[model samples]
Target: MFPQSPSIASASNVDILIVDDEPTNLRVLSTIVRSYGYQVRQAISGIVALRAVQIQPPDLILLDIMMPEMDGYRVCEQLKFNSETKDIPIIFLSSLVSGMDKAKAFQLGGADYITKPFQVEEVLVRIDYQLTLRTLQIQLQQKNNRLREQNERLKQEIEIRQQTEVELRRSEAQLQGRTQQLQQALDELKLAQTQLAQSEKMSSLGQIAAGIAHEINNPIGFIYGNLDYASEYMEALINIINLYNKYYPQPHPEIAKRIQVSELDFVLKDFPKVLKSMLVGAERIRDIVLSMRYFSGYDQAYAQQEDIHIGLDSTLIILQSRIKEQTNRVAIEVKKEYGEIPPVNCYSGRLNQVFMNLLSNAIDAIEEKLEVVEEPFHPIIKICTQLSNSSKQFQDKNTQWVEIRIADNGIGIAPQIQRSIFDPFFTTKPVGKGTGLGLFISYSIIVEQHNGQLQCNSEVGKGTEILIRLPIEVPQSLDVSTTRKVKIAPSSLSLESDIGEM
Candidate 1:
């Protein structure tokens, strides 16, 4: 049967020791402590209690203040001094009834003190209280030790992680540097490839242009040379016929009839006009051949000082067929506002290629506008050029720059894709219409090779303007370097290629 104490200590098996001098008192306390579900041991004196406690400490101790040789205070002091048994809760059960005696007991680390003639309820309650407190202290100490151990392990792990992070960061930095170097090499390789392809294509075009010019110039030269002689011979024959009519008015009826049948008077009047028209046609052909040679620039392969307007005019002449009236749209009107800019030192052929590309794009833009819009619209491309300075276009004052602007009234580019227009293989034109390398190559030629700038400004319904600024005297040994950064204006346009223009 359990003690009816109704205390927390009764739930667990607890060890308790009762120390007293009286055998009867020890027996009585032992029964009560045992009934409370505690394992009780008895020591008849303080000395025996201390010995028993040293052997195996109990959860709590009930010590008596009056005992032979060693009193409760001395025993508690001894127990409190020992590190192993200091935490054991001690309750004093004594016959001494003085205030000093209870005070001394408490001073020596006694948890509770009870006088003689103690009620069983009071003694058991004190014992239960001390035991419960001892159990709580042990649990708290255990938790504290575990927490300390976990804290030490966490600190070690954190140190290891920090060292690993340092090494990883060092490796990452090395890898990033290597990646950047590799990327730079790749870009240079791609640039070289593009330049080679461009050179081959330009060479082929120059060869074709020169061949055609040679083929046509020979026949056209012969026809042009004979036209004048033919005209003079016709005049001499007419004079002889007039003289014959004057000297011999009476002609054979057969000759006069033949003359009447052939409409001689009308032929005589229109013959000079025919010669003049033919002469004009021959002259036009000669001019076209000259323009083709000039545009091809096969002879001027290297950088040289040349009139930019000449190249512009030559490109326009070559593109005359495209600018002519189309089935869907009227002839595109080319408005040239050329300034009195001096000859610019450049690769004339390359510059001409750029001009051809830009002009062809303008025509395409106009064609696109015509296809989508139903309203009557006259397509126009405006080409403007002038000398600019640092204040004008943010160039060096010492170096004069020529600015060329090619504008077209067409379906302008949307704002969102404006930044990507210069990227390689990017295009807005339908599959077969564009090759997407025109603007990219043009950008590379102008910015990288010639050290020039290309800029675009546009509005959706209004128009697009492409501006090119180049130094009048380019570097003598200009090497194609890295691509320059371009700052696009607020609104811009996309570009497509006419690879056939070359």
Candidate 2:
């Protein structure tokens, strides 16, 4: 076993080149290196050594400084300068035992230097030391190269993660915006569906009411016309009975007995009253039919000149049942301040719907208030209409307008929610009681269709006042006088008596 070999397995197949001018020295070094289980090549000169290294590079080299043609210093310089051979360990074997020469050998990239007649033990020790050092350096370099590759991969991964995070944030923002858009669209769709349902229902109701009114008008007209003649005939018959009694005062007892049994006196006294009551009843029926026909307005196909007062009255007549006295509250009072406004050109049916929605809401508010308020709270709706020749709201100075204000003495809307009252599907009423499309449709009919304005003024505890301003469409031939204010005194419209018949 070699004394300086790290292991027999490590020394296997290790190639070394020995160069000198002396054949004996080359043989000796080669033999010694080969005995340590290393493959050796011999060169008698430095030139031969360079050629052998160029042909097939070795792991280690042992060179003599005193070679011919090319010295060990020159060979070492040539090997160290080459990129492929620079890492090979070089040892200097020389007879010159000077410190300067050793220094010179090391400066020329020599690994170790040995004197002439050196011990084999020293030669092997130096070779083993240099080989072990180079092996450790190679392993460290390999580890450094692996660490650098890992760091590069980690850097790339970090970059990819950062990009992914940025994309995720962008996607989240887009999703949020899209969600809001979808929600808005869904709300709009709901509002539209409810409004369509309400419109269809109202249209059907109008048709039914118009049909009923038409059917009743014929019979009521006939009964109303004949009632007067029947009353006159009854009067004549009573006169004949009286005259016959005067002429036949001395009649048979059987005739007088029959008269007494028939209660002729009571008939004579009550016959006229019964006819009068029938006449009154027939008249009331006629009035009700007329009111129903007017309120239905299903036959009105186009915009025409209409009296706003009549529209309001027709809507009130239709809603009279709701305004009637409840168990907890008295009948609601309506105060009208009608101005001398001319007939307005408008869609009477749609205008009536607007009035209906507003008054209905007013009644609902009053009823809601009645729930919490004590007695003595007389709920009232104040309606005021005014005509103006010129207004700042009108773009044309000469144009005229009709302004209406409907106010109530009930629990008012909060200020924060007032602005949204006209928005579709916005309501404070209980679920089944309100569809929330009343005000929204009313707003559309007034502002969008009629080119008018609808605004609300309210306080939380006091009440709400909704003002409507519409431009009056004056006809060519119709004469409208100067604006004059007409006020109707406040009156209680108690529908308690009328609701039963309705």
Candidate 3:
């Protein structure tokens, strides 16, 4: 029904052009090009071929060197010179059979020479190879473009990741630096607290020393006066013994007996008085030693609660020698409002140290403002206790609190200096009279250690009032959400009213 299709025309869709002057040659070349699956364009002359190439460029050109109007040499040169069609390879198809002919074909810019008696297989193979090369070039170009895009994207992602890592490192370094700073500050604070405890201990010893000196002085004075009288009695007794020895030089048994007996009488009369004076002096020394041993026995202060009133009793024993003489110097009144509460857990030594500071300060204030130049006001030291549910100091509603109020009718703290009094090394006493650590240490123990609050309320020219409120129990559960902790040293005494007073 239809003309049989040629083998080359069914093979591939590559567009190939054949240029030749003879109709037979054109038909034959077209057939050969089509057998390899190429789409063939036939131009009878170089002019027609150029027009065909301009319309649709072939992958390769099979050009005939000889033509009536435009030869293959001119066509090849024109096609090679034009940028748009330069890469279309043109192989010359010529009938010239000479070395000169081949040379001329090459010189005319023909890529290859194929004589008129060309084998169809050879022509097909050449066309297929050239077309394959073009396809490879297209693929290579596309691959290169893709690679460039990927490289750029990779570079951008790498830069972003690097920046993020650097920022993270910086943040981590800052956090580490802050942690180190906090640790150093905590270390310094602990060292400072240790030094303060040592200083307070020394101050307490100093007060004890002063008290002892005053106490022993009185006994020494009495002993010295009694010795003077004994000296006089010894002089009289010496005269009597001398007279008796001179008068009774004869060795008589009865006389010796009478002399020994009279001497015994004289000795009995004076010995008892001297012995009593010496015994009193010895007792004073013994008491001083015992008091020092008792006060110094405690280990360095930590937190624990002792009976507040019990501490008062021990402090009274320590201050007896100092206050005994000043008894008439002031009308002193003592009142105790002791509660049935158990011994509070607090730093026993630190608490005693606080009492010593407050009591001494009160004495000094009262003494300073005493209207009777030589006498002091009726100094009354009142200690009162109230069981309050002071939840302010504790966050738990179940916490039981006890309030201890120590009020003094003495010169009060000036408003301007009241705030600064709690500061370490702040003192109004003469240089050696105070070390300025008492209230500061007290503040640390009460507020910092016991989780209590210390407050001072006073007015100038009026009396000072100090109240201490403390929770009896700790909360059932506390959140340990923070890594930082306040390390507390254990102690036997607790500060219920561990308050700082100015």
Query: Where does the lowest 10-residue lDDT sum fall in candidate 1?
Result: 493-502
For all predicted structures, in order, the TM-scores are 0.64, 0.62, 0.40
Residue pairs whose backbone atoms clash in candidate 1: none
The candidate 3 region of ten consecutive residues with least summed lDDT is 480-489
What would the per-residue lDDT of candidate 2 be over residues 139-243, giving only the tens digit for each residue? 777789999999999999999999999899999999999999999777767766676677768778888888999999999989999998998899899999999
Per-residue alpha-carbon lDDT of model 3 for 75-137, expressed as tens digits?
998998898898776788888879998897787667677776877767766665555555666
The lDDT values for all models are 0.80, 0.78, 0.65
Global Cα lDDT for candidate 2:
0.78
Flag regions of model 3 displaced more than 4 Å: 1-194, 197-294, 300-305, 371-376, 391-396, 473-502
Q: Residue 58 of candidate 2: its Cα lDDT?
A: 84
Q: Give the TM-score of candidate 2.
A: 0.62
Residue 123 in model 2: lDDT: 90
- TM-score winner between 2 and 3, please give it: 2
Q: Pick by lDDT: which candidate is best? A: 1
lDDT for each residue of candidate 1 in 391-493, tens digit (9 for 90 to 100): 2445367867888888888887778877877776678889988766678778877777787888777667666788888887777877544444333332242
